[model samples]
Every structure is written in C-alpha cells, then in structure tokens.
Target: MRAFRVLSHAVLAVTALLAAAVPASAKGEDGAPTEAGTTFRTATAVKQGQKATASASAGDYLYWQFPAGAGQRPTATATVNLADVSARHGAATWRLDVFDGLRRRQPCASGEPEKKAGQQDSSVTLTCTLRTVRPWAERWSDDPLPGAYYLRLTVADGPEEDLGLPVRAEVEATAGDAGGAHAGGGELGAPLHAGAVAEPKDGWTGGWWSDRWLWTGGGALLAALAGIGGYTLTRHPHRFRSRPGAG
Candidate 1:
C-alpha cells in the first residue's frame, strides 16, 4: 500500500505538469484596441491578432496590456509613423519594452527593442520577443509566468523639435510556440498578477513550499541504498583465509 501510494503521487505530479504544458488557449476578445493608455493602470487591453492604434506626441509613452498563458511565447511589435517627417531636424530613436504582471522588466531574447529613425524616415519600428511563459516559477526567479503582460513604447531620444510632433502608433502582441525552450517544473494554483489593493495575507489558499520535490528526493536516496544492499547480498562472497604476515 505504501508503494502504491508513492506511485500514485508520482503519477499525479506528472499529470499536473503535462496538463500545464498543454498549449495555452487562444481565447480573448477579437476586437482591435481603439486606443492606448498612458500609464500601466490605464493600459489598453489587446488580444492576439488585434492591432492597437493610438495617436500621441512623439515623446509620449504608450502602454498596452495583454494576457499570456503557460507554454506560449509572446512577441510585441510597435511602429511609430511620423506624420510629418519634414518637421524633424535630426534622427529619432524609438524603444519597445516588455514587462510582466509584477511590473518587472523582462529581458528580450531577440527583436530590435530600440530602433532609430532617420530624419526623412516615415516610421520607426521596434519589436521584442520574450521567453516562454511558465506555469509556475520560483519565488526568486524572474521567469515569465502565466498572467498579464504590459508593453511600453516610447521615443527614447530625438530632437527637441520632434518632442511634441504628432505621431500615429500601432502595436500588436502575438503568442508563438515556445519550441520547448527554457523548460521548468511545477504548477501554480492561480495566475498571479499585480493588484492595486493588497489582500489579507492569510487569504491565500496554497502553501509556499512544495513537498513533492522533497518526497521524490527522499525516495531516490532510499532506492539507491537498497540497490547497493541487494548487490552485496546477491554477489558471490569472497572467502578470505589470511595468514598472519608479519615481516
């Protein structure tokens, strides 16, 4: 019965991990965003395949929010269309930054996060491809977890004349196959995200630690010891008839 119980637990752990690995659903409003938010709190929400457009000054910061689930890789692209290129005196630089639900800046594995636009250029484009989102992550890890993500687009640098220039911006966030990269273990009870109000600490349902890992490690140690003992008992014994050799 003890062995059966252990087997059952191992199966359960594997099942949960496999279930979490399943492809994230493509479920969200299909409508495109009509506008973008200036701050994280007011960030416009967008869905996959939906293009978000906003009209803002060149130096203004635009924010957009999107949902990402485990096993999905998120990529966001932004384009700033210079309505009046002739009004610019020098080149301008644009940047695209991605953040997680915790407001932590996520490192981009690829995509030109920052791009420069020449004086005569009509538009500047920037994009960022992030790591695969995980089902659960260690408290100390900054790994991407399933939850809300935010993208910020802004003109990093440009001439003073281009500061207030009217610009049309478009942003699109899409999820791609993770290609089985950055594999991690474990699962979470819920999708953790940032909240304005702090809930009671005791309100959480799950414990902070995982006993599954501890149990598995202990089982492995016992199995190794048992194997060694069995080998000693099963192998032919060497009868040593040692004579006193005092030279």
Candidate 2:
C-alpha cells in the first residue's frame, strides 16, 4: 500500500512537470515541429488583407508586413505552410507581395503566376496551389536590394472557420561566399533572405501564468476536492462493493 501511494504521487508529479515543460514549439497539422526557422515575434491571424498587424474572422486582405529589420529579405523562396484546413484549403488563393528595401513593390516576372487577380497584382503576385504547402519564390531577376523587404503573404477564399488556421513561413537564403549586390560596397544593406539561419533557436522564456496566486489556488481547490472524494470512497467501501443480498 505504501509503495502504491508513492507511485501515485510520483505519477502526479511527473504529469505536472511535463505539462509545465510543454515547449511552445508551434506545431503543424501533423503535430511535428514545422519546418524549423526563426519565428518572428509578431504573429497574428486575419481574414482580410491589411498593411499592418490586426486580427480577423473573414475577408480578402491586401498584405501584412513584418516590421523593419524584423527578418531576412526573402531573396529566394519564402514558403508558407497552412495546416488543418479541411473546409477550404483547395478553394483559397494566395498572393505573395515582395517589397524592396525602400518599400517600393516589385513587379513579377512576365507571365509569372499569381494568387488571385487584382489591378495591383501585376507589380507583385504569386499564384499558389490552394490550401497546400505553397512557395512564392522570387526569381533571380526579381531579387530586390539586400535589406529589409516586406513579404505580404495573403490568401483569398478557400477555407473558412470560426478560428483562423495557423500558418508557418520559412525563407531560404542563398549560400555562397559571393556577397550579394550589397557586399563589399560599404553598404549596410543585406539580402532579403540573409540572416534567416542566424535566428535564435530558443523560444519564449515566460511561464504559463502571469499571476501565480490564481492558478495555484484553483489547483489547490481541485486537489482538495479529489482528496475529499478519495477519502470518502476509502471510508465507505461498502458503498461501492457488491451488495450482500443483490447480485
């Protein structure tokens, strides 16, 4: 009995520890670590396109920009992975907007694909397969100056739900000793896709709760209720046992 009690306590302690240690690694649809890369500090969900940060329920959007000096300029390919869209993955279209260091939008290559057709899309557009893992790549000709560039990844139609689905993005930079257009020219500019691999690996360090007292008190109450129920059951085994006169 003592050994059993010890084991039960150990199991509870382990459960609490594991729950506390749940790393905030944003999970993909398959629950695997999504393509590993630097996750920007600002992440939001929206239905419509907008130039800045905001939340949304539903609507087509213009574009969202990561802050200046926030991430690498996507010189090569920037992939957006959307997960858990059983409702509208195949129906929605995505437009990838690329901006230069000066925030001047660049035009797509001639006959380049696009997400959805719009008047401004001729300048920056990438048509992606609906609801699947999509890559909006900048052809070498479309490469902008090495520096901060905005990637406006937007999608139209496809899936609709009460909550916006989680999307993960990865930007792949070119690998070589050749400094891009900005190198050796006394230029402070870096390629759009540069420095992506240098992003930190560790995530946020804060605990689950901002205030300790509330959750601690709630947990204590739950533990007390469990203990009381356990004791009551232990004291009256006959209540749960088979009746002497009835099968």
Candidate 3:
C-alpha cells in the first residue's frame, strides 16, 4: 500500500511538471494586424526575429511591421503554404511590397519582388532586404526611415478559381548593423482601429532567455525534487517503546 501511494504521487508530480513546461502558441503571439495602419502603429513593439502566422484567402491583405533602429537595416522573409485545392486552378503569383510608416514604397537591394507557385507546388517563399539610403541633402538623410516599416503580402495575380482557397502565411523580420551611430527616434504611427497595440512579453528579446530547453530542464529538476520529498514523507517513521523498568 505504501509503495502504491508513493508511485501515485510520483506520477502526479511528473504530470504537473510537464503541463507547466509547455510553451505558449506561436501563432498570433504579437497579434498580427490585418491592415496597414494598425500594423504600422504596433510594429515598434514586435521583437526582432519573432515570426507571425495567419490564415487568409486570395485578395486578402496581410501586414507585418518592424522597426529599423537607427544605423540598422531591416529585412523580411515570408513563406506561404497553399491548400491542396489551390493547385486545381493553375499557377498563382504573389506580390510582396515594402512600405515605410508613411505608406511610401521602398525598394529592396536583393530578393525577388514577386513569387509564383506552380500548379504542382504547394508552397512559395519571398524575401526582401531594405537599407537606408543617404539623401542628397546634408550628405546623410535616412531615406528608408528608421521608424516603422511594413511588409504587405497579397495575391497580386492568381486564378479566379482558387481565389477563395486558404493560405497559411508566415513572416519573420530582422535588423542588421549599418555602421554608424544610432540617431533616428520617433513615435509610432497612430492606429486606425481600436486595440491595435500588442504588449510584448516582459524581458523577451527572442534570445537565450526564451529558449525552451532551459525551461524544460528547470521543470525536470523541480519534479525530481518533489518526488524525493514525497517519498521521504510517506515512509513509515522510526518508533521505539521504552522498557517498563528502564529510566
């Protein structure tokens, strides 16, 4: 009976530990905006390298905003997963456009401005990298704008038959050093809709602290300690009866 009780407690502890270690969902972590204005307003709060995923149909506009710190260049990559029904129509072409906070189109230094998914293919990917160009005035003007930048993904040209097919979209962004002192600083653009801002997790930088392995190890250690403590407390206590004549 004692052994059974110990075993039950051990199982419960393990189960609780595993439950606590599960990570939160990656999709919609940053509350991906469905429009341009909302995305521009919330882009500065999104951590670099955090990917956002969402489902949409053809003609639907998906937006992701990111901040390009002063002296930093921003780059974005998007991957689209098409439903099986999408192939029945024909080849589909997608467009990716980069815009500044003011909605002005910005040019990329590399990467295709458009991508196509063949009838036999189920996925397509596109990438864009933007650098700050020095304007003619003052020998240095941040043409790309260091504040908020947006990436707009849409079905520029696709078959009408697959217009309603579902698409799984994922976007990720990063910023690289531009070899100068950081200077640009400004407030985020006003949101066009209510509750457009998303508060990022505290101390989250998409860095070592967010690693899942570290959390898993910590949980395992706590579980082991709980198991040991349970076993010790459940064991029968030592007892002795004093002799009638003994002092």
Q: Candidate 1 vs candidate 3: which has greater lDDT? A: 1
Report the number of the highest-TM-score candidate: 1
Which is better, 2 or 3, measured by TM-score?
3
The estimated TM-scores of all candidates read: 0.65, 0.31, 0.55
lDDT of 2 at 134: 10
User: Which ranking of candidates, highest lDDT first?
Assistant: 1, 3, 2
Candidate 2 error regions (>4 Å): 1-74, 110-113, 116-146, 159-163, 175-247
**In model 3, which range of ten residues has the least summed lDDT?**
199-208
lDDT score, residue 59, model 1?
A: 90
RMSD values, in order shown: 19.2, 29.0, 25.8
The 10 consecutive residues of candidate 1 with the worst lDDT sum are: 197-206
lDDT of 1 at 123: 90
Arranged by TM-score with the best first, the candidates are 1, 3, 2
lDDT of 2 by residue, 178-217 (tens): 2122222122233344222222111111112233446668
